[model samples]
Target: MTKKNWNINLKEMVKVGVHFGHETKKWNPKMAPYIFKERQNSHIINLTYTARFLSEACDFVFDGAKRGKQFMIVGTKHQTADAAKLAALAARCHYVNKKWLAGMLTNWFTTEARLEKLKNLMKKKNTGGFDQFTKKEAAILRRELNKLQEDLGGIRYMKKLPDIVIILDQKGEYTAIRECRTLGIPTICLVDTDCDPDLVDIPIPANDDGRGPIRLILKKLILAIRTGRAL
Candidate 1:
């Protein structure tokens, strides 16, 4: 891949185990079309379509970046948490690495209040207001800060709803997808054979639980976003 152009071939994709899908029994009926065939009782995804869909999704993300659209990345799974944070940070977008707070985007006003409280707690701690208070008061502030950080640390700067959402595990994070659909936010997701591809605007059929593939795909998205920054 060149600096100005980024593309991965079949060999690289195969080396990353992108073609592997869920077992035939666990496969979703809607994903039948994307399945090339059943091999060893498991569905083999059509890498041809995976590449095509990935390219299209990259175009969408890149264009969104050029237009200065905000995107939120959701990846709370063990396999994808680090990749999600890295990708979102690289793209300068919000991420949900821990918990996808309910109504985070759809009902942001109420959510903002919670975020504000978290901010106030941090301010009190930084200002040493707890110094004059009792130990109980100091302990309360500490507990609140830790809880809020675990809940909303990755999304502290999400001042408003995102224009698009990029997710790692569609099936595992279906609630995130559902909220996006309800709010009319377009989504791009990695859909395993068990997931419904129709849930996302762009679905890349790949192993959503693998580190290598998730890393590669997220890298591609980061590259696309960075490239758009130049425009």
Candidate 2:
């Protein structure tokens, strides 16, 4: 895939409000290099840097995908959850948008066990295995299935830890990032001015709270992953 074609211009980024950052008072000092200026008590991210980092991240994803590496997209925040799920689905990648269960990565054995249980429950439901149970028992089992579906639906089939993780909000998904870090998995994050870039492998400084910008970034990343898969 050609990197040039996937590059988004600064004008388009500005239109989507990607340049907007957290309030100046809340800004992280480590992010000074990515901050263009302070406007109206909020930091304005440097779109030029955003484009550069994003391109680098896309290239990395493309190469990894070509090598059959797996990825997991995470965004538990309300504004970013839907977009993350859609993007991951588009690229046929694993995702966790509803909630980031602690030890989802660090405790691989337990997590995999839970995923197995989820698969079994789903299979039983689809095969009408619940018909053998009484009404109350069936209802109780159905409730368990629903809960597992909500919590582990996206990752029900993920057999192993992902090679890389794309996080929409650095602050909101700190626990997930930490798990990745502990497990030696690389991370690509959409970090706002208030977030520390050191926490991620590739930090694409942007407005993590804006749905438009999140969707736009995720769209490009998905395209890169899809292209790699095609190879």
- TM-scores for the candidates: 0.94, 0.97
Q: Model 1 segments beyond 4 Å from truth?
A: 1-5
Model 2 TM-score is 0.97
Clashing pairs for model 2 are none
lDDT by candidate, in order shown? 0.87, 0.92
Among all windows of 10 consecutive residues in model 1, the one with the lowest summed lDDT is 1-10
Name the regions of candidate 2 deviating beyond 4 angstroms.
Answer: 1-5
Positional deviation of residue 117's Cα in model 2 after best superposition, in angstroms? 0.9
Top candidate by lDDT? 2
Backbone clashes in model 1, listed as residue pairs? none
Give lDDT tens digits, candidate 2, residues 173-230.
Answer: 9999999999999999999999999999999999999999999899888888898989
- C-alpha RMSD (angstroms) for model 1: 2.5
Model 1 quality (TM-score): 0.94
